[model samples]
Target: MNGDLNERSTGRQRVLVIDDEPAIRETLDTFLSWEGYEVATAESGEAAVKQAKEEQFDLAITDLRMPGMAGDETVAALKRLHPNLPVIVVTGYASDEAAMRCSKEGAIRIVRKPVQLEDLLSLVKAALG
Candidate 1:
């Protein structure tokens, strides 16, 4: 798959990608864009919260650790703003505890970093549904 998303389904979905790493954010933004998703990127949880408050998104993909608000907080904030919105938490530090915590915080899924693009795309599709 080369970690690239090239297929486009009908009715493009809007996705917000929140991560501190520029490379991760940009890469995801580009890949998802190419996949025909309306993508938005935020470098910090605070910024993500602000953006979510200002706009609507079908799904949100966020890093578990970040400078401003952290993924858990961001997910909570998003839930407050949009209760039905689905969130996916991505983390390099994949642990059972962290995954459980994310689930407790309302994330639809928790994906470990260096993620396969196909897995992510699949999760996004399921979340949107």
Candidate 2:
């Protein structure tokens, strides 16, 4: 799914994408990889944390809702493992409370579902930068 973007110049930044839905995971993996990011995906928050321990990632994009270890918990766990790791939380059920909670848990951004690819990319770039 790698796109036309050059990885040598920019350096392929590894990105962790966590989502329970196969479609969502595929979408992020394809788009991010196309953008020249080395991407890894997990189907649950628990798996995401486990993956994080195994590999180093520049950034993480995760679904807010999941079966075990919710998005906020996942973000917290990631931070615990890597204090400065940046996280972007995406959810179909965006809410003020959820956003605030995620923010408090160390998420860099909380984006609602149906997020525009460009917008997500921009946020990712900013986070990586």
Candidate 3:
């Protein structure tokens, strides 16, 4: 009934993408799918949390800023629900303060936006491993 259910039936690793921008979410969903991952997308952190609670995801890639809950809150919620879940935060600009906070908040990686496919894939692989 749910999108994640379809992905699970395929026996693929599931990834949850949380971003406010439609283009970015679609692009990452397509790219991650091409890279052999089962992808689900949320337009805001609130939606992300809802989806995360409904389904199990191996990883979550979320934007630093969004309309409702920010990336930090999203990561916190995800960690609370799925303690072992790996989260990657993507921001438009590099911020030392944010990076430090996210690190302490349990983010596995903080990546800059306009992410290169290769670098993102490598990070994903490393985190998933």
* Reference-based lDDT, residue 93, model 1: 90
Error of 1 at 36 (Å): 0.8
Residue by residue across 1-129, what tens digits does model 1's lDDT show? 221232123357889999999999999999999988989899999999898777777899999989978788889888899888899999999688878877888999999878999889888888877
Residue-wise lDDT of candidate 3 within 4-121, one digit each (tens)? 5754787889999999999999999999999999999999989999998888999999998888798888889989999999999999965898787777878999998789988999
- lDDT (Cα, 0-100) at 57 in candidate 2: 82
**lDDT comparison, 1 vs 2, better candidate:** 2
TM-scores, all candidates, are 0.88, 0.90, 0.91
Q: RMSD in angstroms, candidate 3?
A: 2.6
| Colliding residue pairs in candidate 3 | none
What is the TM-score of candidate 2? 0.90
Candidate 2's displacement at residue 43, Å, is: 0.4
Error of 3 at 47 (Å): 0.3
> Candidate 2 lDDT (Cα, whole model)?
0.90
Better of 1 and 2 by TM-score: 2
